[model samples]
Target: MGKILGIGLWVCIVTLGAVYGSIYLATAPAGPSEEDAKKAALELIRGEPITIPVIGGGDVTGYFLTRISFMMDKEKVKGQTLPTTELMTDQLFTLLVGNKMVDIGNVSSFDVNDFREKIKTEMNARLGEGMVDQVLIEQLDYVSKEAARKSADGGSRPMETTTVVEGEKLDEQPASSGH
Candidate 1:
């Protein structure tokens, strides 16, 4: 009888402990939840390379070769195709050719920040408010008519490729001769 009583006591104690543990856990405050810790998921969409002609003195002086990328809101773009190519090409032409944003002689005059903002703003305005998160420039380069002719004529002068990032200028690197 005593042994049976002790067994029952042990079972009761374990049952009470389990109940207390469950109650404590259930009543405890939750830590940072997934929703609270989560950030808006953004998707990166890379646009096709654009070539805009720089016309001056009634002639095509040089060509601006640019590749633009965009960061879009994942939720907003779900089940939808963005008209990025058409919009980007049009805006880039307006900025580069129409506005003369880039100076062929003074490449340092290019403002990448303003360029990015305008693109982002215009894209968001066209698509929808808060649809675009950011505008990224993958490539922004200028090839002069002289340089093109020189390379065509087999001149060995290295074709320089300029890399611009977030309004900071990187050193110009020599472009490979071959396509």
Candidate 2:
């Protein structure tokens, strides 16, 4: 009877220890995640404002004027040529023209978060996973075709673009003459 009791006690102790160990492990805080790694050593690269014309029903309706900026991994982009301007332009065209993401008539219904997430996903896929930490919208607005035409007739000069990297101005160039 004593041997039986000893064996039972050992089993119970072992069971308890196993349960405790599993619970502790399950509740323990995890180490730094993939998102944390992406956040490390980030560099801010602000691109020029891109103007995308919105066409619908066989005519030009309006334009999507947006300034796209990014938080990129400094270490990962150290030796690579980041074609952010070209990529962003292509993506914007795809989203605005090809996908018809934004409805000009119902501007308030646009989902800004979804737009940002899609841009980030597409950009990261092209640049490599986790290369683009965040896609930021510094400016986003819509200009009606009539409004744009009026602005042009009023002799408003086009704004110049300046590439800003890490809060420092890199270079300046004239905005594209094309709409």
lDDT of 1 at 149: 73
Candidate 1 RMSD to the correct structure: 9.8
The per-candidate count of clashes, in order, stands at 0, 0
Off by over 4 Å in 2: 1-39, 155-179
Clashes of 1: 0
Q: What C-alpha lDDT does candidate 1 achieve relative to the native structure?
A: 0.68
Every model: Cα RMSD to truth: 9.8, 10.2
Can you write out model 1's per-residue Cα lDDT over 46-148, one digit (the tens) per residue?
5667877778888987777787767677677664463555655666566567557676667677787887888788777767888778887877787887776
TM-score of 1: 0.60
Please, what are the lDDT tens digits per residue for candidate 2 over residues 4-72?
Answer: 999999999999999999999888467777767656677666667788777778888777677777777
How far off is residue 103 in model 1, in Å?
Answer: 2.5
Show the lowest summed lDDT stretch of 10 residues, model 2: 159-168
